[model samples]
Target: MELDEAFRFIGSKGPLKVGWYHILLYALLVFYNCWIIGFQLMGMIFIGHVPKNYQCTPPDGFFTNDTTPVLDETTELDKCHMYEVQDGIVTQNITECLYGWDYERIIGETSIVTDFNLVCGDAIYAKIAQSVFMVGVLAGSVTSGQISDFFGRKIVLHIALVLKAVSGVIMALLWDYNALVASWFFVGVFNQAIQISSYVMMTEMFPPEIRTISTPLVSLIWGLAVSSVVPIALLFPNWRHYQIFISVICLIGVPLWWLTPESARWLISRGQIEEAEEILKKMAKFNGIKIPNSFLSDDKEIPLNEDIIEPSNKGHDGENEGEVHQQYYLLRAVTK
Candidate 1:
């Protein structure tokens, strides 16, 4: 079947174009894709990990008794150094937070920064992990897009969802810093794959009119979630628990992935003609409408053959008319 023919047939169908169910399906797909928005921004909390106002941990028994001048001066602590009394005399000395830095518990109840000692000289490691995640995202975007073009969107999306969930959970539990970083990169890779597949499928399933409206409307929720992460992180005080929370939440929408139908564009391009027709018929029933014969058939099914598409002889002087038709239908089938 020709791609434009399918679009034109659906668009011309009076009942399908105005049907409430049609709008609902498009809206639901948008919501599905929007889940990525909040989850994507969740990385911000980890990346923005900052040490709370930290001071050199006090010596043992420094707080055992009532306030002393020795304690009083050290009360106003500094970042990497603290004060102490030596040999019964008040004196200043260099300290390395050898007892470990103490936090004021300001930005979060706990963070990777404090929990993992990703502070002082080790602060760069957390930032490096964040940067590595983005690098993985970049790599996945290019590779997954190419693979989806060859295979299909929905299958790639499903694989990505599973990989993302697995990697996210692994990242949460990993104790080794390098291993955790590696896990995060895979999480990011699958995250990009899921986002891109869903996006392309959304545009393909819906008409241009629906695509125009649904795209930004769905993104609105993502924008809101960006601000909501701060408050959500407040609910998970420890970085380990928060990471677990994020991973668990990532799976909440997995079942919904099953709700979305595979892209007919992909099916047709792969020459799954019967499957494509079945999807079209299912959509017609759900929309409470019928497909026009031009796209399908009330009499006999339209063969998804190149011969079915006529050459654009009027435009190309009949020289590459067959080529023009091939380009027109298959490109639409591949891209729709």
Candidate 2:
């Protein structure tokens, strides 16, 4: 009875069991690989982040608490308070640093200086840049999806990383907003490509039962990317400077490629059956199982001609008969 229960449990769980290390590695990959989703969310939030350029004053008598005198001139004579005054003129130049040019003029006389040639005074430039980026993403998602499927996922993802690095550098160092606009557009496009590849990679590597659970768990890393950006934005306070910071962090993730394994599905699909079997064997070993010697052979392909053939009668019947005979014989022998 005990042996029967043990056999039943093993049959139900299949031949595979994912261990702690496999789960941890997969979770980490999903986190970093799915970072672009968070960026997409941030980009949507950027719709709010960008506008409200209109300058406004705090209100009337806003600086009423200020009692500091502009000047206090005195001479060392007659109690040295206001005894003697030297013939000197006091003048100061204070223009809008806080309220920008428009609101500054309302408070006092000021001239409109075109200090920021970036993105021009036209907010539409940024709006258009953002729009183009999203469009690039829309198109690249389809294109890269095909590419990753046809080629390997790693190659497709690597290509996107290269594009991202090149575009990021050009955008950060160059003077032309047009170039910045174009580069950022490509950034969105390449980012989508990277994401699609990551998803494909994760899906291929995980087992079917836990596949759905694992894929989204890896995706949770997107939140960290969003949360970290806020501090970088505040600290840098300049757009190009912030872009440089982002570019460097992006470059760091590129080297993490060394840590990951090629997709076992891709290997099998390309007819690299031996390699796929090897990987599966390794996975089994990691899960603390000794894979059968039969599994190690190159005869890994199990042909399925659904229309012409049915399940193997011999193999099925033999398994059932063997188990039943073993149980019956053991009972009879024990009783005798």
Best of the candidates, lDDT:
1
Question: Lowest-scoring 10 consecutive residues by lDDT in candidate 1?
Answer: 63-72
User: Which stretches in model 1 have alpha-carbon errors above 4 Å?
Assistant: 4-25, 46-48, 63-76, 83-91, 106-108, 292-336
Per-residue lDDT over 1-336 for candidate 1, one digit per residue giving the tens place of the 0 to 100 score = 455455544433434443444465566555445654355547547544786566656666664111122334575445654555465443556545556666777655765567667777777887898888888889888888888988888778877877777887888787788898898888778888877887787777766665686567667767775666666677776676766666666665578665667788788778676677777666666654455432432233333334334545544454664564544433233222
Query: Model-by-model lDDT, in order?
Result: 0.64, 0.50
Q: Residue 57, candidate 2: how far off, in angstroms?
A: 15
Whole-model lDDT for model 1 versus the true structure? 0.64
Q: How far out, in Å, is residue 163 in model 2? A: 2.7
* RMSD (Å) of each candidate, 1 decimal: 8.3, 14.4
**What TM-score does candidate 1 get on C-alpha atoms?**
0.74
Report the C-alpha lDDT of model 2 over 230-260, residue by residue, as the tens digit. Answer: 6645565455555555555555557767755
Model 2 Cα RMSD, 1 decimal: 14.4
